[model samples]
Target: MDQLSATLLSAPVLFFILGALAAAARSDLAVPETIAKGMSLYLMAAIGLKGGVEVAKAGFGTELLVALAAGLVLSAAIPFLVAPALARFGGLDRTNTGAVAAHYGSVSVVTFVTASEVYGNTGFAIAGFMVAVLAMMETPAILSGLFLARQKGGRLFAPELLREVLFNGSVVLLLGSFAIGALLGERGFEPISPLFRAGFTGVLCLFLLDMGLIAMRRILKTRALTWRLALLALVFPVINGAIGVLVGTAIGLDAASAAALGILGASASYIAVPAAMRLSLPQADAGLYLAMSLGVTFPFNIVLGIPLFRWIAESLGGML
Candidate 1:
């Protein structure tokens, strides 16, 4: 309860609520789109770089490899469960159902970022190699989404999509920055710490304000998110997140890394998955997937899921 309350009152979250409420009221308060985009890149870059630096400090190990394997398994397999559930519960067709499944299977960078913040606040040491795990998790879920949708009707393995998934700006920036940070080492990161480390939360607050505004607008305008689908949005995260944490613990990850895996498992891909879906499953309804991911799931995870996953991680981590 204390953790949840703290999360609600956190500056970044408050700013997010402020943006959502302002948008819902039809107020004119808005951040510039360009600035919003810049913030997103900055956040991802900083996160990737920090992770790379940590990996450099720790060096490659058996635990890192196992965690990555566990992450890949979850990312690939989760869509299968979600696809059938959407069909059975949400009454969605294969195209829309698989598309939605894909979103849930993929990782959300923002959610992972928020989880890391909460994890830090709780004084748990974060796993540096999880950023690599984050990048690895994005593409396989996309492939699974395409595969599931293929059973219905849609193009599969389009050359363009293959390129897009690999080279998407977020993936590129994160991987590229991670590589750079890895090369720089501790001494190299020191100069940039003032920018990337010191100011991360302030930047995150601004970025989330824009995100809250966008999520609220989607909730208001989109009719695709039914009550049934909305309920699934909440349920899937808890299940997937728990599974992810258990898998990570079994594979020898400490509490923080396991929780990071849980957060990734729980997050839906609003960015990469959406882009792939548009090209691959052209018949899939954008409003449906977007509304469920951006409107229902994103808000829930950011507000409640992060803290819940951390507590689970702490408890389970201690047990491990």
Candidate 2:
């Protein structure tokens, strides 16, 4: 309860709540799209660079390899678990189900970022290599979604879609920044510490405020979100997240890193998966997937799921 209260009262989360409230009240307060985009870019770059520096400090190890492998398995396998539930219970067709399933399987960078902030506030130390785990988790679910939708008859591995999934701007920026940071190491990172390190949380608060606005607005405007699908949206995070935390712990990650894995598992991709689904599974309803991921799941994960996963991680760590 203290942890949850602390999370809700934190600066970034408070700003996010303010944005959501403003949007819900139909206020005209807004962040310009261009500036929001820039903030997003900045957040991703900072996260990537920081992760690289940490990996440089720690060096490669068995935990890193096992964590990456665990992440990949979760990303690829989760869609299969989600698809049948969507088909039977959510009333989605094969393509739409695949699209939605892909979302649950993929990670949300913003959610991860927000959770990292909360983790830091609670004195949980996320390993640097977890960023690589995040980057690696982005795309395999895409392939799985394509496979799930293949029965609908379009080419599964279309050239453009593969390119889009692999070279998505977020993926490119994160990977590029990570490589640069790794090359620079601690000494190189020091020169730019004022920008990437010192300024990170402030930028994240702003970015999350914009996100809260977008998420609330999306929920308000969409007609496609149903109660059943909405329930699934909330449910997936808890289940998948628990599984991720346990897997991470089983693989010998510390509590914080395990919790980080849970955060990634809980997140759904509004940005990358939506674009890929449009290209590959064009028949899938954008409004449905977007509403569920961005509207329902994103907010829930950021607000409640992070702390829940942290507790779960801590408990598991304690038991071991």
> Per-candidate RMSD vs. true structure?
1.4, 0.9
What tens digits encode model 1's per-residue C-alpha lDDT throughout 101-145? 999999899988877876687686678899989998998999898
Model 2 Cα lDDT, one tens digit per residue, 1-320: 97799889888998899899999999998999999999999999999999999989988888889999999999999999889889999999888989999999999999998888888877887999999899989999999988987884466798999899999998898888888888899999999999998999999999989989999999999998889999999999999999999999999999999999999988999999999998988889999999999999999988899889999999998998
- The Cα local distance difference test for each model comes to 0.88, 0.91
Which residue pairs overlap in candidate 1's backbone? none
The TM-score leader among the candidates is: 2
How many backbone collisions does model 2 have? 0
Candidate 2 similarity to native, TM-score: 0.98
Candidate 1: where is the Cα deviation over 4 Å? 151-155
